[model samples]
Target: MSAPPSGPSLPKPESITASLLLGAMFNWALWGVLGCQTYLYHIYFPNDKAAFKYLIYGVFLFETAQTALNTHDTYIWFSRGFGDFLNFTKVLTSPLNTPMMGAVIALVVQLFYAHRIWTLRKSWLWFCMLLVGITLAQTGGAFYGGIRAFQAGSFVKAQTDPSNRRAVYVWLIGEAVADVLIAAAMVYLMILRRGQSHRFRSHGILARVVTITVESNCATASLAILSLIMFAGIPDTNYFTCPTIVIGKVYANTLLVSFNNRIVLRNLSQIGSPSFSSGSNIVTSSRLPLQKSTPSSAGRAFESDTITYTVHRFTETDSTTEKMDHELQETSAMKGSPSHHV
Candidate 1:
């Protein structure tokens, strides 16, 4: 048999391989979570808007493809290239599933949140523009870094190249910044500003939404920042790949969680209103108008006065009802109006 191929001793070979292995494992685990969330959303919100449903399924399918590619990359490294020390140094595979795919998913999620912010307040056009700009830059940096890595064809070259390293720095920093901004804007607009209004100050559904928003965005931002620190601090190994690999899944999960949360809000509303029924074609909420009747000199002419309540009907087909905050705002506006009868 021909002698096995050999090369110079690889620096931190075990560290690099271990990081890749762990990243692959974590990626698979997060994929499972994404699958479950997507399934739950499908079952719960069949009536969701076509565009909304397409976005949900699109991210999910993209994530699925990435997961498959991750598995193939892992297999190539461990199973096929077993005992090949030199494989650790090489680019080995196109990073289509890792940094590239992750960047796309992050961009999609960040932009979705940006749109949400716009829907909340049209006057915040400047804020939304800034967010979109950062998101695009982050994605551009990630793509450039991936291109540089592919051109280098080896981890050593990629790490040593100033341009490659700079691209990665830009990508990671931008990702973290974008995530933090999205989270902060959401909390401020949805909870702080909305809650300032007496109508939503003590709303239970709003509290739950705030909690989910904070948890999801914080998770992604923390991972991005951690990856940046590790990549910068430990230039000799691939430790950063661990968190970087799972970052895409976190974005996908964030989107799914946002979609699935309508179930929770719907349940909360049902509990708060006894008349609320599930799967009803026409959902109705009645608001009682404030009325003051003076006692008549003739034995209370108020006998003719009758209590009046106006019913606001929301149909399942209404696209505006897909967003909880929007629905709540509409309900509040209707409740505040005076009821006039002909």
Candidate 2:
């Protein structure tokens, strides 16, 4: 009789090594992008109120450190002696360790975002809560399950138990749900805000800043959702299987970094232009007549007529006639003034 069919092969060692390398590369590149974006945003907008920008920068730093650690671990796993490598994995994946710390940080950031959304007085509050809740649920589930598995020694357990597999399933499902919710909320918010363009009264710097904030958040949320979805299909075995997990992680990080960079660039471009408050004309009406010169012979007569000239001030009316008159007068004055004096 033919020998019994062999069971499905465990993931190959080579695959694991490749995955780890890729993951490390991905994280490094992602952080690099984040750093660049942060630099650009700060240089361009220089907004003291944007405390979250620093938080984002901190995230990039943490990711960079994590990437370095992961790279070391991957090297140990693939190139160092087997005993030494196994020891390294144990230390790195220990229940009470840096990986766990990183996971906690991630959760904290999500909660912070939720709090911000809760402060909004309109439908945004509900929308933000839903997105935040879904994200937290997924992230929390994965984190808790992973910790449990690590505690039970199932993370590296030789005999794959159904319980261990189930834990992974829960984590995956949670991540997927979170991704979908975040994506849906982002798209909805974008649509809602698009309708409010007509309500924007301010122009120049203020308007540009507001536009950037809205666009960046929407883009970041959308990218995050897309990355999460891409991660949903990753096999449970590949969680620590190396190359596959690494690839997915890299892609997600890159997307986030790219979105941030785009926002920063757009914001910077707006900052270089003449600000609306400084450049726009103000409309003011006066009953005073123009000053006329007296004739040398003292026989010339002149009639007094009301003349209106627009002044540059902080406030101006929205009347079309007033705006047209202001522009025409300004143009005429410019042409009549001596070029050297002006």
Candidate 3:
């Protein structure tokens, strides 16, 4: 009789478990850094226009929750102690709670950005609307799918029936698509602002490049996670069990941390620039005139041409100074006093 056919080998559980744990730890660290940076930016330099600190906070929170869920799932698979309970907990907490919070944060950020663009009277409102619509659709789809998976108890069944794993795949893909759209919109906005600065050109370029790179890495990591979910469909006997999921989580978290750091550094540099003081003064003066215009009808009528004049005199003696002041007044009156348009 022919020798019995050799059975397919199972992956070493210890190796896979170790990698997943390490990945989760790294992700947690990254999330902590991101959160800290957000707090710093919001507190120290609240007036920085380029800083959207909340984006980092939202992404960090979601990724941290995701890493926790994955780590728990991997632990349960290897340890086999209360595996069903842990799996159910992850399902209920991650795709439903975490993603919903992230979606809301992202929507608010997009709306704020849209308002900023509208204030500038730019023509990119339609493009922003399209991007926001797609992002909302993807987030909503993923959120609903996650809720269904939790309700159906598919996380417990993933170890047995591979067909029930479609929910995970759908969630991953939806998130990836949303991330890509957001990144694209951000990059486009940066490009639009490229030509408007001279003193801060390098900073703008670096910020835009870093933002694009981080978003691209995030999208790539999401795709990698989706690929790992596909591998989960394979039979346990023949599964190779690579560290793809852990690596994806680590990459995603790292990108978010880097993005936050860049934003903080950029804001600090802007605060130290000379233009900041001048710009603030100009803004203050502009608002003052607008506020004072409503005090009287004459003020309103003169608002368009109300000019403030200043005279400067330099002399070695008081007599010469007085003479110079008189000459300056005569010159001003002869020229009809150049008026400023408010």
Which candidate leads in TM-score?
Answer: 1
Better of 1 and 2 by TM-score: 1
Ordering by lDDT: 1, 3, 2
Kindly list the per-residue Cα lDDT of model 2 for residues 294-336, writing each as its tens digit: 4444223332466443345444345643443343333222111
List per-prediction Cα lDDT, in the order shown: 0.75, 0.43, 0.44
Q: Which ranges in model 1 have alpha carbons more than 4 Å from their true place?
A: 1-9, 191-202, 271-342
Residue-pair clashes per candidate, as listed?
Answer: 0, 2, 0
Per-candidate TM-scores read 0.77, 0.53, 0.48
After the best TM-score superposition of candidate 3, give how far the Cα of residue 341 lies from its true spot, in angstroms: 30
The lDDT, on a scale of 0 to 1, for candidate 3 is 0.44
Winning candidate number (lDDT)? 1
- lDDT at 65 for candidate 2? 59
Show model 3 residue runs off by greater than 4 Å: 1-23, 46-121, 154-170, 190-192, 196-342
Query: Whose TM-score is higher: candidate 2's or candidate 3's?
Result: 2
